[model samples]
Target chain A: MKLEIELIYKQYVDYIYGFIYGMVQNKAVAEDLLQDTFVKVMKSDIDKIENMKAWLITVARNTVYDHWRREKRKLNLMPFIRRKRRDIDLKLDIERGIEKLSPKLKEVIILREINQLNYKEIADILDVEIGTVKSRLNRARKELRDSLEG
Target chain B: MNCSKIEELLSPYIDGELSRDEIIRVERHILECKNCEELLKDFQLIKEKVRGIEIPQPSLRIKKKIIGYARPRNYFLRIIFSTSLLTGLGALLVLTLGHQPYIAEEKPKEYYIMKEERTPYMEILYETEGDYILTNYEGGSL
Candidate 1:
């Protein structure tokens, strides 16, 4: 059991971490979410998971959403608190633009571009049709390009 | 194909997800339509930039911490067993050797301090201190 979990960790660590980081845009938060993602994976019945990578990515995505929901709640409670912006490098301007996108658009872009998951895989993860994925990706690219240009 | 139809197919076309017939139609339309061609170029640039964005690797400490959580309880037993075995071996060696302490000649302690200095052969275009130090020279770091 330990060996199986370790193997899964070694296999999907980069993909899971990249996906989480792409969503959160914060290394510390991403790492915490990554830990939570694997813990969820460990608790799940591994035998039932047909697509391990997609499963792990879905868990990571949910973990990010949960973090965001908690953050949103906290902000609502303390409306005066403001989140500080981190220093983003010039090279990461594209990534910063991605971070500014709406959650639905940002998710498709990350799943497609960063994680390099196929349309079918992304559709499966997001529980949306392939057409919806296509439209979302198109809108996401358009928004990202406009932001960068402006 | 109309421009709007072509625009709808643009994402799938760029992703190579379109059917062969659709790909041919889009290609033919793009050749004659300047707007669609420019849109394709823009999408290509967006794809390139997104793909080029660097993803930071999770720290090794975090990896260890997460993997440690999944370790089975038997791992502890294995560690304890191995430790006991080593201790037993040590006791057996001591018992066989008798309590006579072996004395060895003492040697003076030697200390050497080493300093590393990097002399820039050419101009340093960029330098960042971290896991990766990317430097660009007149020619190239490579």
Candidate 2:
């Protein structure tokens, strides 16, 4: 069991962090909450868990929500210079274009492109139907293309 | 299908979610039609751009920090958990042993007196064998 946790942590911690960072956009906050999410999973009875990856993602999502609830009164705790410069020009442009999208569409794009999640997984994460995920992702991609082309 | 219907299916087509038959129909329609072909190109451009967007490799520091945070030995939570555990144990100990429920360890009896001049003494008027005692002196009453 201990080995399992260590292995899972080693394999997925960075991926989970990147996935969440893409959403939250603040590394420090994402880091703290990522830890909180793992702590939550560790404390939970692991025997009941069937899908560790999905379960971890759900925990991470819930932790983000809880963090927002606790810190809602604090205004914009994100540091200004913390936004790292993009490594690739085109990728950065696409990322910036994604940032310009509405939150709903942006989430779909991030989940699909950045996270590389399937449409069904995106639908599950967003708690929407698969059709909704398809539509939102399509709209997000269309918006990005138009922005870049123009 | 009409142009709008074909356009609506283009996104799913690009994703390859359509059936093989549907793919043939769409391909044939786009091959002959200028407007549908243009729409297909636009969708294709979007897909290419999305696929081209590089996965920004996180720094060693970022990885360290994330792993550090995600580890079980979380700083704040550990402190809170230990402190609460200690407090609960202490409270349990006090409840179970300090204030013995079965023994009836009487609280120290408090005596009040109004003094006029001297320090009044407690005079035992009657005495029992083991523990009980009575006091009757007027000075003791005062």
Candidate 3:
């Protein structure tokens, strides 16, 4: 059991932590949640999880939501960032622009671009159809562009 | 297809996720529609930029901690230590109450004060005790 858990942690620590920190955007919070996530994985029946990446993602995402709920602070407020375009060519405040996005839209964007998960993988993580992933990304990009354009 | 229809496919088009038929349709439409051409440009550019911002990697310390979860430890020792500690404390409290017949007369006010002061701590103790009971029931030391 010890070797099994260590192997899984060694293999996916980077991948899991990146996804968590990408969502939270905080190093300290991410670190705590990373430990919590691993604790959960250790306690669970690890051999039963066929798709480790997806399962880990689902657990991490819920852990983040649970943290937010405990704090009573969701990512509703546009965090304070300068309204400078993130793109060299476009006029979007990349950080502010993403914060402006609805959480659902922002999630799909993060899963796709930051995690580099394809639509199918994202679909599995979000528990939505593949078509929903495509549409959400479409809306998210459009909103991101419109936020910049205006 | 009109620009709206083409716009829906543009994101997938950039990702090469569209069906061949949808791909042909989006490509043909974007060629003629300047608005959609720009939209596709923005989607691709934004996707690239979002990917550009570095994700926070696990610190070496955090990775070590996570790996430590997999390490074997004597949780049974923890269970025994805590159980014994609580049991000893409970026994001491009961013995003190039994010996102090005079203090027992003043118990109502003291009980109220202690309840007010110690409710939160007692709740925590109760939760821990509940976990211990469950752990024993499950035949696991965790």
Best TM-score among the predictions, by candidate number: 1
The better candidate by DockQ, 1 or 2, is 1
Model 1: per-residue Cα lDDT over B66-119, one tens digit each: 777775558788799789999999999989789766657766455332222121
Q: Candidate 2 chain B TM?
A: 0.47
Mark the regions of model 3 whose C-alpha exceeds 4 Å error after superposition. A73-92, B73-142
For model 3, which pairs clash? Answer: A85-A92
lDDT of 1 by residue, A19-107 (tens): 88888777667877888888888888998888888888888888888988877776677566543433444337687788789999999
Ranking by lDDT: 1, 3, 2
With candidate 2 superimposed using the best TM-score fit, by how many Å does residue B106's alpha carbon deviate from the native? 52
The local lDDT score (0 to 100) that residue A130 gets in candidate 2 is: 84
| Candidate 3 lDDT | 0.74
| Per-prediction TM-score to the true structure, in the order listed | 0.74, 0.60, 0.69
Each candidate's iRMS in angstroms? 10.1, 20.9, 9.0
Q: What number of backbone clashes does candidate 1 have, counting pairs of residues 3 or more apart or in separate chains?
A: 0
Local accuracy of candidate 3 as per-residue lDDT tens digits, B1-142: 7788788888888888888999889888888999888888899888887888776567887777677657455789668878999999999999998997675455342211111111101111222211122332124442
For each model, chain A TM-score?
0.93, 0.72, 0.79
Expressed as tens digits, the lDDT of each residue in A46-99 for candidate 2 is 778887766777787778667655544332442222323332232356666765
Question: What tens-digit string does per-residue lDDT give for candidate 3 at A48-79?
Answer: 89998999989988887787664443223423
**Which residue segments of model 1 deviate by more than 4 Å?**
A88-91, B73-142
